[model samples]
Target: MEVATRYARQVAVIGVHSPKFSAERDPANLAAALERHDVAYPVVADPDLTLWNQYAIRAWPTLVAVDARGRVVARHEGEIALPDLLESLRPLRGPDGFVAGDAPEDASGDEPALANTLRYPAGILADAARDLLVIADTGHHRLVVASLDGQIRFTLGDGVPGLVDGTGDRVRFRWPRGMAMLPDGRLAVADTGNHALRLIDLGAHTTETVAGTGEQARHRMSGPGAARETPMASPWAVAWFAGELWVAAAGTHQLLALDLEKGTLRPAAGSGAEGLHDGPLAEAAFAQPSGLAVAGGRLYVAEAESSAIRQVDPATGRVRRLVGRGLFDWGDRDGVGDTVRLQHPLGLAADPDDARPILSIADTYNGRIKRLESETRTVARVFGGGDREQGEMGDEDGVGTAARLRSPAALAVAGDRVFVTDTDNGVVRVGDLATGRMNVLRLEP
Candidate 1:
């Protein structure tokens, strides 16, 4: 996109994620391709056009014009012409909008333009919104929260060493590993240390334990002696889907689906706690299930020892392998003779705006993120692989960050931003989902 077209504002562009596009679609290359020689303003590199499909765009460059009510007023598509671009941008230009090309409604929506900054530099990964970014500073044994502009919103769970109802409130997270958003706008933390699900009420500014009052795992049952029935065995990842909370009970080697509203738990895709199969629940199991992400009524799980990404059909306990050749097989590629396999994969998420429910896998050992199109089970390489240093796709060294991202462990995507829990360096790196540029949401430069 020409910098002039979306100058001083934000806009997202969509396209099919073809090898041809990823190869030639580098941001630096975009300016040259567009004949600007140089350009600014992020051009959301949506290879799958996830946003396009969901937002109902007929073609590329379908600009969704939002109103103050956060509703899309107009949509422009197909190599937007100058006149069409101007027309699509009219509402955001006047005094009513926040920035250039920003819709009138989005102007005052929930996201804050300025990001809050903190002193934690070792941020390994971050998950957040325009208003909030959760940093998983692993080395520090704590999770950090900041505003959209990188402002230090607050660092949470800095105290205690237990997992239970009384371990700690929002202020204390015991080595929290991952973060997720609740339906009510509250924040959920995989208080890893305590082996529990922690909740943070954004409105109340208070923290509480929503699940696993005790630091242990068990099956979910109802009634009478059912108090401790809903247990998670070393639960590592958490996801909100279909109005329920799902946990990867690594300790038990099973996926525990919880009805957060009713406080009920049940064996979801796997019956028993250990095994990998489409057979009955008990026959199916996992080897240290870690990352958990939900989209389009399906759940994705990252099996560490097994080295496979398992897809779970929520309604029926059906399971299938999305990636990897076999259990404990570490290769460079897949199907090409045991090569290109995931090494110690951890975090996982689905591209919301995409039609394929693409699974973004943080191949931890590979230091890269792999986008797996669930529909076809094909994989595309994104930020990561052999060079874990810093930059858009810099997790090449068995660590997630190229430079700013020291070790990305978790994934969170809200609105137009993508966050990673850069645990090693102890800081969360927030970037624009479209441009993939390092976005610091703080008051400081």
Candidate 2:
């Protein structure tokens, strides 16, 4: 987002995408991901890790500044403040610095079209009682509200990627990712690209920024920053449990919580370190925790980069890893306890009707939907399987064998059906909780 915002400032921004998963190496998938993120800058796919190895980069997101003579000036590993970065580039913009190109500074093109069909939808919220389904049409930069039977109703955002607050169509969101319904009839949104949390008042039909200062936080913070004052770094998913809204701050490698009643934001788990460690909330560590779900009294987090599922007890401030071994150990092997394996899972959904806890995981890199039994601590692939292969839309539908999925990013359960955002294919899939049969859902304009 910062790169896109600063593209017109006479500074060159190059996006070097070095994918960790084999599925992401494909040119089509890489293009889809870049488009989904709304990266308007020039980007190159480092499939063979050539660029990464050349630059000696180790982190998933690394920034490097270079002079016109091709000498490295600055390099930062994780998230950083854009204002500070822009300030540092001012000196280079002068006559004695890097030469300006002949191309236009505002390289970003016009906004894309708005349609009922989704493109790279990442998050889903299912209201069973009201029979309403809300999808985060991320690539299109809008939220699609439709009935369970597929009737398009309310559409949030004007389909333009931006950060504007208003009611209904007037409101804008930049790559909104996750959503959680609040007890007060409002929806808490992880407005990811904008680095902020937005609240959607269902009754008032208005949207407002409640958390984050609209800038990504550069460093780790404890509890000093208030709700609207503090900045957030790539908040991926959110869940409402107990009395607060829990956020999976992926870029910061930690879990943050918002005191709904008090309207304050604080770090709830992890110490901003990227690794797999389990202990107290403040002492524990996480690696890109992306998806969050609440079951019973504990919060289940899907650690994306580590391919792990973790359990967090808010009352006792205890954090423990339920599955996955480490950051590098990832595969499709399934077993009990430490033997279980998952490959870069991004979304989780707990079964609300079951007394025994059960979570559905979107194992993205493996192109499968897995089921995790909380009591037994066992992991199994319930649907979809293959080595970085996305099957056809209905190829595995109604077959007793493993169901096929194409980079499923998010899941939502309503009664016996599990709704999935098949991101790579740009469609929604419904899987039966009882039989594991899958089907594609189409939304008409």
Index of the highest-TM-score prediction = 2
Model 2 TM-score relative to the real fold: 0.90
lDDT at 204 for candidate 2? Answer: 72
What global local distance difference test value does model 2 have? 0.81
How far is 127's C-alpha from truth in model 1 (Å)?
Answer: 7.6
Candidate 2 residue lDDT tens string, 123-209: 998878878888998877778888876677888887776788999978888788889888777888999988889999766778898
Candidate-wise lDDT, in order: 0.55, 0.81
Where is model 1 more than 4 Å wrong at Cα? Answer: 1-130, 138-141, 163-170, 218-231, 280-282, 334-340, 386-407, 415-417, 430-445
Which parts of model 2 have CA positions greater than 4 angstroms off?
1-11, 87-115, 386-402
In candidate 1, what are the lDDT values of residues 365-407, reduced to their tens digit? 4545556777777765555443423124332222223333333
In model 2, how large is the Cα lDDT of residue 251? 85
